[model samples]
Target chain A: SQQGEEDPQALSIQEGENATMNCSYKTSINNLQWYRQNSGRGLVHLILIRSNEREKHSGRLRVTLDTSKKSSSLLITASRAADTASYFCAFFSGGYNKLIFGAGTRLAVHP
Target chain B: GAGVSQSPRYKVAKRGQDVALRCDPISGHVSLFWYQQALGQGPEFLTYFQNEAQLDKSGLPSDRFFAERPEGSVSTLKIQRTQQEDSAVYLCASSLAPGGFDSPLHFGNGTRLTVT
Candidate 1:
């Protein structure tokens, strides 16, 4: 099975509202990273949180990693219409160089 | 020079036909990866290459899938005898090093293959 699994497969929120997505993994990891995909285009790197780090912030995005529970959460505050996209969580295992991705969370930010 | 580049943005092939997809990674990148993504899902690992060496290909779904990175720069993913179940987006990504702890993978726009 893929290492990461994201919750709330689909979400819809009004503009300016906050959106939160959660991800759970099954194994110990070196780092967890978040990516955003618009339509069918390629994924864009968003934020990354290392196993040793509890939380990280990038602009309007806040990511938290709880290695004990093997879970992570991404919080987007004050989202805009541009934020409507599919967000995925991928993990890099300490044992290998390849990254495994979660199914992803589809977010729709209404204007 | 510019992020990862993949050709044939869209491809349509008849069942049992063979198709090839190309990828040109950023110059100087040593790590390359291939992934398959079905509709409404995240990309799944397909293969990995370190320079000209294919270190891992455990993710390939079947023997019909073949990938190579000759000269350690450009890559090609070829699918022989395609099946309807094989229709999906083929993604290519590249990174500067093997660990990828310091450099995250840069993905291309992807090649959407439709097997009719």
Candidate 2:
């Protein structure tokens, strides 16, 4: 079974706008990571935030984690058409070396 | 430097037939992984390998699924007696050894397997 579930299965925004996607997981985890997939290709790693860290930032991307709530969110600022893709949140359970993913949020950025 | 790469970007297999998918990880990468992704779902873990050792394969759906990395650089995933339910995109990823909170995985384009 999948450990996490993402909110707002799909999102659409214009260029330069911001987009946010939420994810909720069911179990204790060591860390959470976000990835992006373009078209029908492979996923590209976006960012990872450890359980000890509440938030992280990478350029136009920002991620927040709340273990108490077992939830996480990904924010993209100044979005571009290039950022149009499906975003997924993968959870790494405590001591399990394997990462489980949520259903994912599909984002569309209109130019 | 080359990122991870997979062979036969697309494949069509008849039900009950066997199919092999290959992955070539980035040079010197030590941790390799395979995943299955349905049309609208996130990729699910299928297996993990550390060098030539198969450390974890708990995610494999059934005994018909097998994977191996003979020399630590290239890996292969084989499915015996494929079923219609087996149709999906198969992705391969690799990371540096002793992966931690920051070891970002590099992924391949994936093989789109269509089982009829």
Candidate 3:
């Protein structure tokens, strides 16, 4: 079963605007990681936020994690046409080797 | 570095037929994983391997699905009887380190399997 659930099943925005996506999960997690997938392509690791860490950044991608609420968010600044893709949040269940992924949020950046 | 590699980019099988998908992970990588992605959905965990050992396979949907990594490098996922519900993209990933919750996975493009 999917442990994480991303809000806003789909998002459409201007090329230069910022896009924010939210995710909520059940149970405690060792870490929450975000991934990006283009149409018909495999997943690309974005950023990982450990349970103890509140926030992290990679390039223009910022991720925030709130363990108390079992929620997380991903912010893409200055989105470009290239940023159009489906984004997913995966949870690392403590002691498990596999990651439980959410359905994902599809983002479309129109130029 | 060359990332994880998967073979038979596309496959078509009739219902009840057997099919095999192959994965060639990065050389010397200790962890290999398999995932299934349905249309419009994220990749779901199928199984995990640590070298030659079949460590975790709790994500496998049923007994008809089998996976093996005999030599600690190349892995194969086999489906005993193809079903329409089994049609999805099978993704292969590899991590350099063990399943220590630290290393990130590198994914391959995946093989699209269609069951008719």
Candidate 4:
């Protein structure tokens, strides 16, 4: 079964604006990772934040995890047209080795 | 010298036929993972390999699905008696570290399989 659920199934924004997507999970998680997919291609790992960590950033991607609420959010600052893709939040259940994914949030950045 | 790669970017098979898909992880990567993504759905875990040992297969849908990473570098997922429900994008990924929340997985472009 899928462990997480992302809100606002789809979002569209201008190239220079920021895009924010939220994910909520049902179980305790060891870590949550975000991935991006362009068109029909495979996923690209964007960032991962452990349960103990509240937030992490890499380049324009910022991830935040709130264990208490069992939720996480991904923020892409100053989005670009290249950033137009489907974003997913994959959760690794605490104590399990497998990663379960949410339905995903599709973001479209227009130039 | 490169990232994870999967063979036969796309494949088509008839129901009840058998098929094999291959994956080559990044050099020196210690962890390998397999995932299945249906249309409009997130990728679902199929199996995982830590080195040459498969640590997880609980996510595999049924007995028809089988995966092996003999040398820990190259992995193959073989499906026997394929069914229409098996159609999806199969993805392969690898990470530098083993068994931890810190290791990040690198993914391949995936093979789009269609069982008709």
Candidate 5:
């Protein structure tokens, strides 16, 4: 399967703490993306990193990609209870035009 | 502007019944995708449409699953002879350009189907 694998299936943290999740893929990819989904809601796009880029940052969120290792990581700084959701990593491979998603990491931030 | 819209937030059907789900993508968006998400798992790719044309459907589980985007705006996914395994959330997403690139997808809340 071209599906990536996310590390730490679940994570629990307190508000104001940092949370990190990692994803590993099996094939070379064009780009990687992160998404967040609240319970019973659709996924919201968070960030996208190309295979040539090493890292990218958005407000309160940082993503790093290592093509040599075929892995990527997402870090949320000063997380809030509202940040609690499932985080998924999806990637597009060379031949496929669709993004393949991995089983997500469920995050819980307690207030 | 409104985001992607899906009709029939929830549906319950008996085994062997047929069901159709609807998706209204963001206006002017050219790419549409369908995914099936089982509980506690990641969303699985089902099909993709660029405008009114279906470019890739390799992820569709079986011939029983059918999808179409008649006018390059609204799309439908129809399932025949539903089974328990078909119980899942059907998600629809659209992008400004063709997918698998830098364009991020805009998604709908999705329709949950339950087969008994």
Candidate 6:
């Protein structure tokens, strides 16, 4: 499957704590993107890190990409209750113009 | 500006029936995509369109599924002989970029289709 695998199918953290999620893919990619999906809602784009970039940041979110490892990670700092959502990693390969998403990591941030 | 919009927020269809889902992309967005997401799973790419041209549909599961964007602004996904396995949420997303991976996508709330 072209789909990537996300580490820790689920995670729980306090409102003020930080949460991290990892994703590993099999093929080379043009860029990797992270999305957050609230229950019963469509996904919202969080951040994107190109294969050539080692890290990128957006507000409280941080993303890292390691092309050699074929892996990427997303970190949420000072997570809030609203941060509770399923986080998915999607990689766009040159071969496939569309993004392939992982199963996702379900996160629960307790207030 | 309005975001992507998908009609019939919810639908219930009996097995063997045909169903059509509609998506209205963000105005002037050059790229649109359709995805199928099962319960507790990530969205799976179904098809992609650049303007009115269907550039890639390699992710479509079978011939039972068909999608079109004739005028390049609105799109429709039609499922023929719907089966129980076809029960899933259909999501539509549009990007400002033409056909590359550089831009982020704006997604609709999605239409939840239940096949019984």
**DockQ for all candidate structures vs. native:** 0.72, 0.68, 0.73, 0.73, 0.71, 0.69
Q: Name the candidate, 3 or 4, with the larger TM-score value.
A: 3
Preferred candidate (lDDT higher): 2 or 6: 6
TM-score of each: 0.97, 0.96, 0.97, 0.95, 0.97, 0.97
Candidate 1 lDDT over A1-111, as tens digits, reads 577889999999999999999999988888899999999799889988888999999999999999999999999999999999999999875357678999999999999
Q: What CAPRI class is candidate 6?
A: medium
Predicted candidate 5 versus true structure: per-residue lDDT over B5-100, tens digit per residue: 998899999999999999999999999999999998999888999999999998898899999999999999999999999999999999997764
The sequence of per-residue lDDT tens digits that candidate 6 reaches over residues B1-116 is 48999988999999999999999999999999999999899999989999999999998999999999999999999999999999999999999888747889889999999999
Question: What is each candidate's fraction of native interface contacts (fnat)?
Answer: 0.65, 0.63, 0.67, 0.75, 0.73, 0.63
TM-score of model 1 relative to the true fold? 0.97
lDDT, candidate 1, equals 0.92
lDDT of each: 0.92, 0.91, 0.91, 0.90, 0.92, 0.92
What are the per-candidate TM-scores when only chain A is compared?
0.96, 0.95, 0.96, 0.95, 0.95, 0.95
Tens-place lDDT digits, model 5, residues A1-111: 437899999999999999999999998888899999999999999999988999999999999999999999999999999999999999875455688899999999999
lDDT of 1 at B7: 88
User: Which digits, one per residue and each the tens of the lDDT, describe model 1 over residues B1-116?
Assistant: 68899989999999999999999999999999999999999999999999999988889999999999989999999999999999999999998988455568899999999999
lDDT of 6: 0.92
lDDT of candidate 6 over A1-111, digit per residue (tens): 446999989999999999999999988888889999999999899988887899999999999999999999999999999999999999775454588899999999999
Predicted candidate 5: interface RMSD? 1.7
Candidate 2 lDDT: 0.91
True contacts kept of 4: 0.75
Candidate 4 lDDT over A1-111, as tens digits, reads 687899879999999999999999998777888989998788888888888899999999889999999999999999999999999998777445687789899999999
List candidate 3 segments past 4 Å from native.
none
Q: For residues A65-111, write the lDDT of model 2, one tens digit per residue.
A: 99999999999999999999999998776445587889999999999
lDDT against true structure, model 4: 0.90
